[model samples]
Target: MARFFGWLFLIFLLGATYFWQPDFFQHSYSILKHGDIVSLAEYLRSFGAWSIVVTIILFIVMTFTIVFPFMILSGAAGIIYGLFWGVVISWTGEVIGAVVMFIFARYFFRQIIAGWITKSKYLKQVDDYSAANGFKALLIARLLPLAPSGIITAVAAISRISFKDFMLATIFGKLPPVIIKVLIGHDIVFAGENMTRLIVLVIVVIGVYVGLWWYKRHKDQNKVKY
Candidate 1:
């Protein structure tokens, strides 16, 4: 029965990816880059109480695919709903997306994932380390802007980290970056000659990239030493 369900999920996931990916890949990120959010928001508001529901649903789909990552949706959410509601909606959607992917990867794709991880020493190391230090491993990685949310989900799933640790780490780790992106979006949407906040947001983004670069350099150096 379990094996049957495993195959069932795999087939369904494959079909969904095949049929749904082309359209999404072509335009999803493009929407973020160029779509008129004011118009989009107006359309959403036409849905009345269901507008946020539609937003959450689309957000979850995008997150689960792990194609665009969380940042793309983060800014848009804030644009549509302001910072506080944006953060709440984004946090919920991202968490649900991660949990769904994690479960599917851990169960339905375990064998395939195991084979792939064995081919990469770094991934194997992460898996082993996560098994030992679930909370710290996930929290630290998720906190780092360098760490892609998709990879974090994969590692946690493969390692089968406890729900408590995974849940806590995800909540804490994802909060700050989500806050940053949403604020940037909010400021941009409501900007009226006060460009200082935008300037600061840009600086913060640059700092995140620089920090990631420095950490990677240090990590690589340690790797060479060992």
Candidate 2:
């Protein structure tokens, strides 16, 4: 009964969020056009209560095995909470979702390789490192968006990676991109022009290249069988 209401609530939330995307954009635009930074921040902060409510609501949805519900909620968080708290709430929801998926994979799908994943040599290498470095590899993977963080958690769990390392690495590695995305969203909220988008893209590209170069020199190659 409780699970049923959870699913029902998620369906309603997803519908409201997706079908109303334009509405959200217009609402944001209206707020930004008329309100200064302090007023905008206050208006957004007022929605913090709604954000927490939605996060909790999505937590229940995730526990019931609905992934789309969480993604929709993440976007809604960005739209409603205005990036900073959006990242915080979304990250919290995602980490919890990853932990749930980890547990589910361990208990239910221990031997299933799902063919798409089994064929990748790179993925195998990552899995091997995930075994040894446990959390650090998870953290790096989380930071880079090289792999889905949820998958990292599940693979780590199935491989019996240390929980302490997994949690710590997940938190540490996921922080950077979350921070970056929040800043990007904040800029979009304020920039009010297409030139800003172009500038932001260039900056992100440079950032990615630098990140890759840094990894090439600093990443530990010895831990993997490759």
Candidate 3:
């Protein structure tokens, strides 16, 4: 009964939000489409004392829905709250949202997903790899800009990775990207005064990818030797 209700509630929440909240989502889309950070910040500020709470809630909702890109919200956080607080708000919301999704996916879909994995050698191998290196794998995925957070969370939730490993990896792994996005968002709105910093960030991102590639190649070579 409880499980049935849980699924029902999830469906209802998504459906209601999607259908009933067209105006709010439309406005959000407009803001993101225009890349209007200042306007977003102003809109959040209109909530007065509850602005932070509103921002956090937005992050949580956006996690699963992807109504608009999370990057826009992170940048808006930077505009509204500055560097430190922006990162804090964005990280807190993203982590919480991710954890919620992880739990839900694990609870409701793990068994079904496990069955599917068993039927596919490729999926089974991927799941095994995730179970073995959940932390490192999840962290790397979080760092990459193109990797979808929702898919990563769902994959980890269904794998053999322990909750502790997932939480620790998520908390630490998400910080760098959140911080970088927040900073970049701030810089974008501030007339590109921090162009040097942006350039450095780009270089750092490239370095991370290069390092990951080298590590993978080295590991593959060792595997072949053995």
Relative to the true structure, candidate 3 reaches a TM of 0.85
How does candidate 1 fare on TM-score?
A: 0.75
On TM-score, the leading prediction is 3
Those runs of model 3 whose alpha carbons end farther than 4 Å from true positions after fitting are: 15-22, 214-226
Q: Candidate 3: global Cα-lDDT?
A: 0.84
User: Which pairs of residues have clashing backbones in candidate 1?
Assistant: none
TM-scores for all candidates: the values are: 0.75, 0.54, 0.85
Q: Model 3 residue 204 lDDT?
A: 77
Clashes (N, CA, C under 3 Å) per candidate: 0, 0, 0
Give me the runs in candidate 1 sitting further than 4 Å from their true place: 1-3, 6-36, 115-125, 145-147, 191-194, 216-226
Q: Is candidate 1 or candidate 2 better by lDDT?
A: 1
Residue-level lDDT of model 3, residues 1-226, one tens digit each, is 7779998998998789868868766777688778788898898888889989888877877777755667788889998888999999999999998999899989988888889999999999988888888889788788775456777888789998889989999999899889888887787777468888877876876887888889999999999999
Q: Could you tell me how far off, in angstroms, the CA of residue 158 lies in candidate 2 after the best superposition?
A: 2.5
Q: Can you write out model 1's per-residue Cα lDDT over 92-194, one digit (the tens) per residue?
A: 8777777777777777666677898799999888667777789987887777653578777876887847778888898889887778766766666667754
| lDDT winner | 3
